[model samples]
Target chain A: MGRQVPIVDYLVLDDGPPHLVAGRCRGCGALYFDRRNGCARCFGTDFERVPLATEGTVRSFTIVHRAAPGVPVPYASAIVGLDGGGLVKANVVHTPADPEHVGLGMRVRLTTFPAGHDREGTEAVAFGFEPA
Target chain B: MDATGTVAPSDATAGDEVWVLGAAMTRFGRYPDQDLIDLGAAAANAALADGGVSMADIDVLGAGNLYEAGSGVGQRLQKQIGQTGIPVYNVANACATGATAIRCVYMAIKAGEADMGLAVGFEKMGKMGLLGAKPPSGEAEAFEPSGRYGSVMSVEGRLGTTLMPGVFAQAGMEYAYENGGVGFEQFAKVAEKNHRNSTLNPLAQYRKEFSLDEIMGAPMMAYPNTVLMCCPTGDGGAAVVLVSGERLRSLSDEQQARAVRIGASVMTSDPWTEGDQVQPDVNTLTRQAASRAYEISGVDPSDLDLVELHDCFATAELIHYDNLGLCAPGEAGKFIEEGGPERDGPTPVNVSGGLISKGHPLGATGVANVYEVTTHLRGEAGDRQIPGARVGLTHVIGLGSACCVHVLEKANA
Candidate 1:
């Protein structure tokens, strides 16, 4: 296989299904997908590495017809409440980007795809949600 | 430290009072040729003229700008308006930039730090969109990993490639799905209302009104938000002159008669939360700020004669109706249906067309809100004046997120 890399450092790529790495606060159990110096909830600096659930439910979504440059338009962006008590914002993919196709409280699963390719032909992978 | 291990009390809130002696703003619209310095100077000069004061009389200067201007920008602005070697402080709090500047001057005069102060806010957003991208910097890069910065990169990397319109549209959709049935029509009604209200405002960016059908038919920027429902980016500036009661006594009777008392000014930031609720996430900050302002001013929301809220988007105004205590939770649609917030209604809102129609020049918006409220309080808002307006409130929210609420009362009321 050719070289591949994750767009954000929080996403782990392996032979198996993609996993989201997060920092779990030891005191308050608050999870952060990105590395955090401290926990805002409990003001605790101690944290443990944890992997988030790959399944989630869409709490809210919108079909954005316009976005910043280089971001493809007409994508369904959603706030997905994960199964184990965390929230993630990701694009709902593999379905039409419309209110009829994607909706609130819809079941979705984490999936990975190639967002872009480097000049060296290396694929940069990104994560999204698909209908579960 | 005291012997009892308690610090001595600071007389920050002594018996001194602050009043807005003058308020002025440049018409909010596109001004590609004008720079930030020029806009800021125009507003400052106009406010001084309106107050019948000279630049040499301004003791301190507080300037607010979001993205365009930075370090030493305040000094540059003051120099343009004939600086007098007074201190100039620059403040930036996203959309609340202008209001924060006003708050700084208000507190300074109340604390007897200065006899008179000027609060000016200006923006020259040439092509920057509503949610513009900040230039790369070390601070921005450092905050990127924490996901605390509300940038396009952070939002897109975490969520999808969606802008602000999408974020707010999701909230509107979620609110509609969860609460008492609200439809796209209700959102369009807010746009229609604000656009219609703008016709009476000479300084508004969009003076044309559109029918509900036309608004609904406009190209959708997001699912629920059409182009007309969103406030367009523009260039403008606004300024306010604040004076202490001691200084007001020294001023001429004409200037004192035009003054408006600063009843209260409260600023609040976002509370730390584990996750975001689609409806009441950032809005909770607004509620906290507004509650404190009402308490400090001893003015109930129902008793207020008018309101100038941060209506950056149509849904935001709808949500603010409940957040600002203008109506009960989930009754925003009902409130609009009853014409409670119209110009001649029980409580006039955004009589100056709000951000949607008045144009959002970011840093200028909060100060512009103050200018509008002050105009009505002084009985000078011709054609769009609220009849016998006594008390008015202004609220602005900045996104990483800070909220500032200011309550104004007629000097003699």
Candidate 2:
């Protein structure tokens, strides 16, 4: 691989251990993964970049068997409520995609994997949550 | 605005109201041979003939479509039928395209811009597989942060897939986790009921009935929603003719007798909510529209003789029971268990088999739901007819988030 890059701008791969960066609304403290013009709840324009907690619990999940072309199926996709204060949508990795394997309220932690490589051989890393 | 948070006033004056002079839908099924115009004209002509009027009498036309929305579908349809040189409104609001089209006509009449209007929705979709979010064009060229996040393909499979089944499955699972009693069986029963109901609708894409065993045994599309529970993509069209109250009085006695009064029409988008940031809250906007429709119509949820709700998935149907106020919040499980939505039950729902079995042709679905309700309100729905149906409600929700709800009442009821 030529160079490793985080799939999203919010994912900080250079700083020691990989972690997600989010914009915390200064007004109501609402956390978001990407840049925002204004807070949806409070309409706050100012925000601070903050690193999210590495651990969270699954709020909800689904075993997606059907998907668009080129995407793998039977993966456990979840809505994870991060510790401290935040919610995210991501895939639950290192486990089977089933109710018995991935369940609601299950504890998980942030993890990264290679998404794909571009023409220049730069590896794109994507983030997901594995059972903690 | 008065007390009670906001004022609820009828869209029309006390004496002047909008009425559905005629409502018609071509049987929802696959039609690889016919095009959009052919299907649309057939439905439009049927509605005009049913209303005992010609296209010359229509002052406005609203066309609801999605695939070819930018091409002025309304104008193209006018060319097929008589070109009355009427103002045409072309609208595309995701799955609610058809209902939005009808609303355009309804508002035109209610605003006194036209005394008579026509709204038609048609689709020529053949067979599209699972509805999923596709990567944005030009974003996949290089790995870069384009807008909200990374390149669409770069983030693919990282954040849960936004495929329709997965989105709704997660939504349903979230509800079941928060509110106890909803399970695999509860969801399967919904598909079973709709499939059974489809047997009575001759126009439904699938008329065969599937048992609970069959539904549960079907291939899984998502966690709780099986392939059987999902709506099939197909081609069809539906149309409705609307007239002002004054114009209704001028029609023949038989025509006036068949007219279904438009009690209330309301459309709402998603309100600011915290959960919506993480997942689509399909309940809130639907509840808002349903509440507003009830307030404006002065009809309680209990007063509804029948309902035609958007059941794009079996899971969607369960939560909408609560969203539509058919049952108390968190009581949707009990509502399904007790057969509350059965055709012969107190609150009959999806008697037309819904999008589940009746088939969903995107543009056609929204107006088709209205057509189902209007048919029952006119006492024209045979076989599957709810005895002496008087008041009925039709609801449609399109996820980029728009919802439309209309309450129909038998004239003079």
Best by DockQ: 2
**DockQ for model 1?**
0.42
Candidate 1 lDDT over residue span B184-235, tens digit each: 7887888888999999999998899999999989988887788999999989
Pick out the ten consecutive residues of candidate 1 chain B with the lowest summed lDDT. B136-145
The CAPRI class of candidate 1 is acceptable
Model 1 steric clash pairs:
A89-B159
In the range B1-413, model 2's lDDT, one tens digit per residue, is: 22322223456563468899988999999888899999999999999998889998999999999988999999899888988789999999999999999999999998889999999999988887766557433324356557786543545466786778888888887878778889889988999999999999987999889989999989998888999999999999999999998888888899888988888899998886766877677889999999999988888898888999989999999989989999878988999999999997779999999999999999999899888988887778899888878889999988868999999888541
Interface RMSD values for the candidates, listed in order? 5.7, 2.5
Cα misplacement distance, residue B151 of candidate 2 (Å) = 2.9
User: What TM-score quantifies how close candidate 2 is to the native fold?
Assistant: 0.94
List candidate 1 stretches off by more than 4 Å.
Answer: B1-15, B133-158, B276-280
Docking quality category of candidate 2 according to DockQ thresholds: medium
